[model samples]
Target chain A: MTEAIQKTVQPIGVATAALETKRLSAWFGDLHVVKDISLTVEKNDVFSLIGPSGCGKSTFIRCLNRLHEETDGARVRGEVLIPGAGKRENIYAQGVDPVSIRRRVGMVFQKPNPFPGLSIFDNVAAGLKLAGVVRRNVLEEIVEISLVQAALWDEVKDKLKKPGTSLSGGQQQRLCIARALAVRPQVLLMDEPTSALDPISTARIEELVMKLRSDVTVLIVTHNMQQAARISNQTAFFLMGELVEVGPTKSIFTKPKDSRTEQYITGRFG
Target chain B: MIELSSRDGVRKFSNYFWLAMLCLLAFTAIAPLFFIFAYLLVRGWAGLSFAFFTEIPKPVGEVGGGMANAITGSLVLMGLSTVFGVPLGLACGMALSELKKSAIAKMLRISIDLLTSVPSIVIGLFAYALVVVPMRGYSAWAGGFALSIVMVPIVARSTEEILKLVPASIHEAGLALGLPRWKVLIRLILPGVRAGVTTGILLALARVSGETAPLLFTAFSNSFGYRGLSAPTASLPVQIYTYATSHDETWRQLAWTGALVLVFVVFCLNLVTRILTRRTV
Candidate 1:
């Protein structure tokens, strides 16, 4: 696994980046949240976004999958490009359906919201089932693989029929990850996924994210600097609705080019 | 330990005093309902029999008869009204909730709220004009349509309020899964709020069960049960009204029994709603 990942890790021109954003900005009515931001997310990478409260880190990633516009009066003005059916296409282009965009770019919210009234197995199979996958054996196979991939198969295998909310806090978050993974998304975007959990659960999620680099590109937004340093290969620091700095995790933390990034990282001010 | 002063003593006295007051007010509010229920049970019990559920109402001089036809009519009207009312109400509620700030949604909200307060008799007249007049005859379909008018505003308003109570995150979760807005509302939002939605529906059903004014003009009271949706129907409320107002002793007694039956059916509907909405976990 290490050798295979090493073979593909090298930046091959523009092909390695799974997602690219150009001059992307978002607003909720008149309150601008995500200012013009441009960035690239490499494939098979764990990219982390870190910032203080109200920095638009969450809103920034939400725009990647076209979810930000779901907010009332929210508008997006920029371009998000992702590899489409054949070539990379701008997601924000007119006539593009946001539903199809979301199908390929799955998201995990900060709170672990498993579909209420759905059993664990059903929750995992929800994406495929809603998209018109009807075969029972196929759903079962995918559900098992997703649960296994999320590292939750051993704990939840016996209770696939139980409600997804019946699991522990940490387990529910992992189940959501499993749910997002079931569709085999090209990119997975997480927004503060571990902020609400205990320390142990947070550690488990961080570990799971690291292991996930072999399968899906993970773009995670977090409040914990340690979590960002631990899980992310690339880190972007957001401040006051703008991208302050983004670089390799080591360089950004050790010697940030921007003063605000340095201050925010060094725990001086946010 | 703190010392017990006159202030402490007064605090204890006021606490008991308020608790007693609240209890008294609560009992005052609820005691009349139970008393009325008991009165109905005592008065109506003697007239109730197997015949009341299986036979149609007889003429004034008849010694023994029942209101089976009226009971069946009520059921049919409820069925038809539900078919007409529920989907429209749910769709309207979902739309209003989703696009709450839109001009059309605001207009719809005001119209529905006004409709809820409109007299049932006026709605009866509406059904009389819209259905009975157009068809050139009073029929069960008209009655059902009338009841559905009464039902729509109640169901729609309640459904909107219930859907709004669901956290925004739940809806967002479904959308994040790549489901369309309608699909999210169907597979996720609606299912999560099923208990609330069912309660709203049952509320409408209970109201329809005892509706008299609308059915009086639209259904026009058949001697026997309706043969088809196109024919005039006998309903429980109209039968009760007719019997209760009649000078004959037997008809008056039958009215009490019909009233009892309507209340019992409504009670059962609420019980079923509770059972259906009970938490599975």
Candidate 2:
């Protein structure tokens, strides 16, 4: 089963950056939130972003999926490249539809936001339906697979018809992850996904993130430095809208690259 | 210690006094609804019969009559109003919520507020000029148009408020799925606020069902059944107004019956809205 899973998840070509951003900056009207910063995320890598409150980590991840500019008066000026079907495409290029870009990059929010109106099955099937999949058997199969991948299938399999919001906070968050995975996005962006959950739920989500690294590149924003150090292979530290440092998670935590990074990791100051 | 205890006693007394006052105020507000319902039942129950619901009104001096025409006409008018009003109002509301920071949205919000405050009678007059005059007579279409206008602001304002209650994160989640903006709105945000939007629409329908002033000049009164959308229609509220003010005792009784039926329908709609909202939440 493990070998089968690895065969399905392993990339066809030599591993390269699945997502690359150049001088990405975002502003909310007159307020410049994300400063000019560039970063690259390797294929199948679990990359984590860590920062204090209002450090623009969330904004930076939102920009990857074109969700940041959805805000009123919010604007992003940057080049985001994603590996398209056969070639790489610049997401910010003219005529590139944000809709298609979003389809390629799925996102999970800070809070569990299962569609309150839909059944658990339907919640997972939403993106598939959006992609125009009409066959019932196909939808059922995909929904089940996605839920299993999110580690939520065992708990919710018997009550697929129940409302999505009926689940516990942790289950609902996993349901959201399932919903995101249903679309088979190349990149999965999560913004503080486990902050609202209990410790066990948080641990479950952390385990799921590790498991997901084999299938899709995972980019997560976390306020918990320990969470970043635990799951992520590559870690980026941001402070006051700037990328302070980026390195292997072990080096960033143990070896001091920058005084600010060291201070933040040590619990001296945020 | 004495001073502190006395001050606490005074504060506690004031709190109880305010609670009593608030309860009294609430009862005062609710008292008239019960009294009106009781009076309607007493006045209207005796006139209700199988014939009262299925047969047309009798000629003058007749004792037995029904408001069959008025009931059907009210349904038709309400249906027409809903068909015209719901889609337009929902679209306006979605636009307002999506483009909240735009100058156009701000202007539209202000205009919708103004429209809500506009009297139903003035809307009837406007419909008179727009639809009635063009057709050369009062019409069910004109009446429906007036009621639809009245419904628009209520639906739009309530929808905007309800959609606004949905967190921005939900919208981002949908957008991040790569669905187009319209699809995100129709599939996600709209479904998220389904109960609220339904409640708003039902409330608007209930409000318009009780409106007599708008139907007065637009639908006018027909003693007969519906003669299509272009013809003058007999709505429950308008027929009730026509009959209640007449000298005949039987007509007045029928008017009371019509009022009772109208109140019942409105009450049922409100109940359904409440149930739907509760289930969603």
Clashing pairs in 1: none
For B1-281, candidate 2 gives per-residue lDDT tens digits of 99999999999999999999999999999999999999999999998899988989998898897999999999999999999999999999999998887899999999999999998899989999999998999888999999999999999988999988888777777777888878877887787788899999999999999999999989997998888988899999999988999999999999999889989899999899889788656
lDDT of each: 0.90, 0.91
Candidate 1 wrong stretches, greater than 4 Å: A1-12, B1-26, B271-281
Please provide, for model 1 over A1-270, each residue's C-alpha lDDT reduced to its tens digit, 9 standing for 90 to 100.
999897557446367779988899999899999999988888888999999999999999999989989987899999998888778899999999999889889999999989887899989998899899999999999999999999999999999999898999999999999999998899999999999999999999999999999999999999999999998999999999999999999999999999899999999986
What's the distance in Å from true for residue A72, model 1? 1.5
Model 1 DockQ (Cα-based): 0.62
Query: What DockQ does each candidate score versus the true complex, computed on alpha carbons?
Result: 0.62, 0.59
How many backbone clashes does every candidate have? Answer: 0, 1
Candidate 2 regions with alpha-carbon error over 4 angstroms: A1-15, B1-26
Give the lDDT of residue B59 in candidate 1. Answer: 86
